[model samples]
Target: MEKLDVLVLLDVSGLEDKEKFEKHLKKEGFHTVPDEAFVYTAESSTTTFSTKAYILEVFKKGLQKNTFLDANLIFLLNETPYPAYYYDKNSNDFELSESKEAI
Candidate 1:
């Protein structure tokens, strides 16, 4: 299994209750990063795909609860950052688009 560091950056400015959003992320096994970011460690055979799936699931749940408005999710594999997905307000879901070079 490959271990990767997953980071979820959420813009909760539009959320009616920011605490509810934070609680939801914590309940889903994400750790707070002092600011609004959430972090997690994911082990998977296909780190890229697994990270994308995880982000999609989070986006789905957030959309259902109207807690997540916009967000960007990324995973670091061997310290190389890769974007998994991003929430688009127009689509109301995660969109996989061209991402910047892995850092």
Candidate 2:
């Protein structure tokens, strides 16, 4: 699989373990973006380059587990022209983002 650049807009408003989540992101190859609030970038790879699959296969099972229990994640394909995807703690699946606050 080809590596994809992911732009992550992390909403950690009610997260209790911000440091732990940040550490998890770092371990996942994500790095903070300069001058941005909770923005990070990472080179990720998906089996078929599908954003939805990536969320379910990676985020839901890993990074978005207990570490981000109260956070919302908005992922953008940095080098592709695909629509963004949104994931929240309560949602088991991600969707095409319609939330203006996240975009």
User: Which one wins on TM-score?
Assistant: 1
Candidate 2: stretches off by over 4 Å: 45-52, 55-70, 81-102
Residue range 1-103, candidate 2, lDDT tens digits: 6777777675645555656656766775678798897787777676435654554354444445554444456666755444555554466655556754554
Q: What's each prediction's TM-score? A: 0.61, 0.58
Per-candidate total of colliding backbone pairs: 0, 0
Q: Give each model's whole-structure lDDT.
A: 0.58, 0.59
Off by over 4 Å in 1: 36-46, 67-78, 97-103
C-alpha RMSD between model 2 and the true structure = 3.8
lDDT, model 1, position 61: 76
